[model samples]
Target chain A: MIVAANPIGQAITWINDPLNWTNPGGMLDRLGEHLTISALAVALGCLVAWPLGLWLGHLGRGGGLVVLISNATLAIPTLALLTILPVVFASGFGKTPVVVALAVFAVPPLLANAYTGVRQADPEARDAARGMGLSSAQLLRRVELPLAVPYLAAGFRTAAVQVIATAALASFVNGGGLGQIIRTGFGIGIAAGGGQIVAGGVLVAGLALLAEVVLGGVERLVTPKPLRRGRQRLGRPRAADATGSA
Target chain B: MSFRLSYLADPGNPWFSWQYVRDNSDTILAAVREHASLTGRAVVIAVLIALPLSVLAYWFRPLAGPILAVSGVVYTIPSLALFAFIAPYLGTGATTVLVGLVLYALLLIVRNVVAGLNQVPPEVREAAEGMGYGRWRRLFRIDLPLALPGIVTGVRLATVSTVALVTVGVLVGHGGLGQLIFAGFQNNLYKAEIMTAALLCVALAVVLDLLLILVARLVTPWSPRRAR
Candidate 1:
């Protein structure tokens, strides 16, 4: 039987072909690579940003500057960052450059959210904790941190989703990921590779949406019980507040 | 750093070269123009589309959640994936990038529009109505004026982000400064070219942001926040 000629048909045929998924540097390998890069970048970002953000928030110092800097960072295009890192590092096409770029992209949401979350914690709770003779560190560990869980979770969700989506660009630098499928398809020429290209796009988009949904659940789950009821009143976390996440 | 054109061809491949800038001034200007135009057009169109939809959502409270949700989902999609998905249908070029950029701008614009509209005091609207102002007139003269600050803020955010995202259009061969950045990366990692393009992008964002802030101030001279 003749393979269907439409792009969607070709994409379906491409996905249906078990050989496509099982082959080396195929969909599964790309998927694994994508996840690894995303995970590493997000972890690194959190390590650097969380402590700084949380400390600043607790101190109520540099909050305005943090917001300004965060906003400025958002204006840096993701593509430019991805391309420039490798040049600055003098590294050839590989995961390191991509990871660093993605990490930079991930920092704003995580840092801003963490800072805002803690700073916006209930003033009464802070007073009570202080009144009860809690130490500074104890106040942070027991009172502020717990209350900041939802914000932290929301920030994590945004970072993860943004990284997962941006990870597709790794292929442009030969960093290898699901983006490789799309890049490879382009190399093969659109006429023959339309299915492959479309398939790659589908996979990346689907994976990003999936991360968003899953992390959204995690964000909900991590909210303290009393806060859960007031979640709507608190307002939805504005993920768009991040620059390149768009 | 030398002004000599030969420095552009120097074997050392330095990351910064004034010679390169002199030689490529036209190309650089063209890229900047393209980047700025794409960003400006996308944001303008997004505001147009977002404003009416925002009004609808505000007037009909039931629609606000879904409107915001859809835009949020669109924003969540990776820029490359969206471009790739649309390329087949639209083919590659400015059109594809413009469409994608506009979609990305919608969430910021819509949210801001809604927020701006919400900031209008109920008493002002009531006062406008008491003066026999028509519904549309009240909205135009009362609601929108008060909402201008928030709307401008949204426009500022969308414009800056779009400036950055315009580089992704290079995926479809339309990424203004992104073209230079990509070309430099491909040409054995030409650091000067990449750095120049990237820096210009950041500079452009800053300039536009400042310009919008100026516009916002001029438009909302009466804002209490401004008085403070």
Candidate 2:
């Protein structure tokens, strides 16, 4: 039976552990590797999902099927996929498999959000673009895409969070990351108490919070100012109309 | 079942025999049943806890942001790690799994609850107040009804997430569809195990999705048919 040690104490002990301090660079390197894997997975997922989402949104056909498949993919549990993939491909233990698994997991939100965002773009604006002799590509690039940016960014935010969180699960299959610290902390000798466990939990939780803050910052930076200004303008007109009618 | 030439042709191969598949049917059925019951319990517990918490969070706007943030942080923890982390405190049982699932659902439910409450037109609230309805009466009789659609949507999303997350319960030796998945990995029966787990999970998700749609229709009879 495990003893219940104070988490704060354990965290202190973990921080003071000579081994962790000695190879602080190693820990940072591992964190970098984890980030690299997560970033690549998101990038690849965006590359594939963005086009599909755009096409699906534009056509408004095949959306049911696309949504079904994407939702199904989302429902596919990470651990289950991790367990199954390694068998089909023998090389599933390391970074490659982890990246692929994460990418698959990441695609659904990106696809769904992008599709919804594009479809939700102002129809009048789209029509105006077309009436101005803008090509389909130009319409998408300048009108629909820009308007859809916030929604797409929201999707990316979700994907980024999920990827960072699930990356820890990769350690179960010996895929290295901050998860290594977690697994090692848990797998230590039988007398192990709350300290190491809490420490590990803190590490993972810390990483998750870090990812959210960083991605949230990126989202704010990338979102166009004109969109916010337009929304504000729209809101004011609506409120005024409501007041006038009232 | 009738024996075929193909069966006889590969008599030496274990997989070629109908007996092999037949022999495993009972085990598979038992596993499936066990998984269903565990998942059902987890989801029920999650809804029960999340619904009230969501309502409370909605009522207290000052607390909404922090509550939602905390839940979001909880949501972002890897399911397995979360389960493992809590297993020690709660012990490895359905109770622990239930708590974890409930915590996960909080993020989605609280946001939806708040959104739904906020979506209630200020005029409606003012009209209710002007008509002398009390806070609880207005909330239940007017606000909640209007917010039903959004709340239902949130529940649907939470249902899907809860279903997916329950698979991690298997790691702590609790029975679920994850059992098939883990077994598949260990025994190298990839197709049998993975296919079963994937199909079951997807089917559960679809079923929940449809069930929630029906519930929404029933609850909000006058609601527009627009999809969010």
Candidate 3:
């Protein structure tokens, strides 16, 4: 294969390339495309998961079915999904297909989290919301949603990481991104050289790290400060209490 | 069904080519054999390293944060990217793949080990020490037993992640079940190849997880009964 050639020398050459650094647009454009695909997938996942999870959590039925399906879906390998999705959709290849495949992969975490978040919402809060002459819709929006933000955000973080990783798999189908560079380099037996492969790998890793940091920050910002403080205070005691009870 | 079979048997159809099957079979088998040996070795090495490292981390609380942070960063990198990054140094073939898998397994195993160690009630450890048990005796007899469940949980997670990450080895032409899936995609033989690989992966994960839970029970009799 391409890697059989002197990989170290090739990698060094790719890394030292003036064109990669000097023509920053190429790299940036690919990064932008990757981010766009990931973001869209995550957004679409949220739309599907939020409603379904809310319904299951509130109604307290079909949860087993939902969980079973989602868990099973989680096991459907990304490459398999990417391969099969195109056959069914006839889109052939591109960002749209990548987003669709990733969205499917992303949905389960959000759905699971949303269900858990809503189900685990303090019953007293729900009762209080009911006693306050609030409508069901109002109770859901004001009490359930606000309470579920942290869990939902946790799910979003999971989705974010999965999307970022799988987004690179899109390169296999000739869909453009850093994966394209990595796959092509490897395909041509140049990946062993370390330059294009390392560069591409670093770029992808950097993107994943950036996503985690940014989204984690957003999660913290959106989560209520009092709730955050409560979590800190409750964390140790709750664990101790749970262990004691057990 | 008979008509479909007849169509498949037709000489005019490309699907009837024995040449395609013959040429790919040797490559596929070799890839599977090599991938399995590499991954198996990697996991064994990782467990040995991680288990000791975890104990040391627990004993030296100050080291935990940095060690965990480094592992966590390693964990976040996609398997393909990680393999690619190491490929230059290790070069291709089994060694590079093994190194990448071991690194990937470390973060999960270490976290579980730490959690397992922490779960040993302080009083239990103190009582063991008070009984004149040396650190080694206490660790092996008391701590390790109690920690088994958590460690097992970590092992289960690592197993699934390892199975998935092993697929990335295909990118370097070190193939396994991923080769089957990839070939299925390449040949457009969707059901026969992709489904077989997918089922095998899921089966491997489930079976291994179940076996670990059994091992945990056998090891830790005092622990609460595991959830079904």
Candidate that would win on DockQ: 1
Highest TM-score among the candidates is held by which one? Answer: 1
**CA lDDT of each prediction against the hidden true structure:** 0.84, 0.67, 0.70
User: What TM-score does chain A of model 2 get?
Assistant: 0.84
The residue pairs that clash in candidate 3, if any, are: A2-A189, A7-A192, A7-A193, A11-A193, A11-A194, A11-A195
Clash counts per candidate, in order, are 2, 1, 6
Clashing pairs for predicted structure model 2, backbone only: A10-A195
- When 1 and 2 are scored with lDDT, the better candidate is 1
Q: Which candidate has the highest lDDT of all?
A: 1
Cα deviation of A191 in candidate 2 (Å)? 4.5
Q: Quote the positional error of residue B224 for candidate 2 in Å.
A: 7.2
TM-score of chain A of each: 0.92, 0.84, 0.83
Interface RMSD of each: 5.3, 11.2, 8.3
Q: Residue B53 of model 3: what lDDT? A: 88
